[model samples]
Target: MPTHGVIRRFNDTRRTKEKMTPGDLCLLAHFYGVSVEVMALRLEDLNLLPNGNWGKLKAGGFRVREAQQQLGLGPLPAR
Candidate 1:
């Protein structure tokens, strides 16, 4: 699915911001055993974000951080 679609899903379900959070991206990165930057690059490579915008990726990263705090996921592990 496209990045927007994914973000929408998360937002709708979790009532989060329109943008995807960094914590969300971080969770995905951790699942894939990759860094958040790598995940963002991969998303861009997959044409998930329009025009490969890095700003959206960064916003998503922030959202993820917020989500993590709410969920008590604690600070992300050191890279």
Candidate 2:
């Protein structure tokens, strides 16, 4: 999908302004152990996993809020 169209579609379905970008896609690919092409296609088709009552977003890249949960990672302690 075109960049503009992707943004528009993302906005339409998402209630928040936080939409995935190319950079995010790259990270998601790494976290999910998938190719960029696969991730991008999933984003474009909105079929990465599945949609339902759950707040399962097919978003690219890891949002700051979900970084830990998505990757089972934790934030570093403050010095």
Candidate 3:
């Protein structure tokens, strides 16, 4: 689950229709059920990023885990 602050941030970003961030392309492509190749992401990899947050499998397998914190997304990929 997401924290209140995380939820608030999501809402604010949504309300503002801000520009896309690093991982947004992957998620939006997933949502639209389209190819993610432009983002250099495979459609199958979407499974490793549920709800737009890196899953445990991906967290351990990719450098993205480190980016999560660097990007202020949280420590445990619980975002």
Q: Best candidate per lDDT, number?
A: 1
Q: Which portions of model 2 show Cα errors greater than 4 Å?
A: 1-17, 47-79
TM-scores, each model vs. reference: 0.44, 0.36, 0.26
RMSD of each: 6.5, 13.2, 11.3
Q: Give lDDT tens digits, candidate 3, residues 11-76.
A: 454576654344554444333344333222432243322443334335546454354445454332
lDDT of each: 0.58, 0.48, 0.40
RMSD of 3: 11.3
Could you tell me the TM-score of candidate 2?
A: 0.36
Measured by C-alpha RMSD in angstroms, how accurate is candidate 2?
13.2
Flag the better candidate by lDDT, 1 or 3: 1
Worst 10 residues of 1 by lDDT: 5-14
What order do candidates take by lDDT, descending?
1, 2, 3
Encode model 2's per-residue lDDT on 1-79: one tens digit a residue. Answer: 3545555544554544355544455555554555545555656466533433122333433344464346554443444
> TM-score: which is higher, 2 or 3?
2
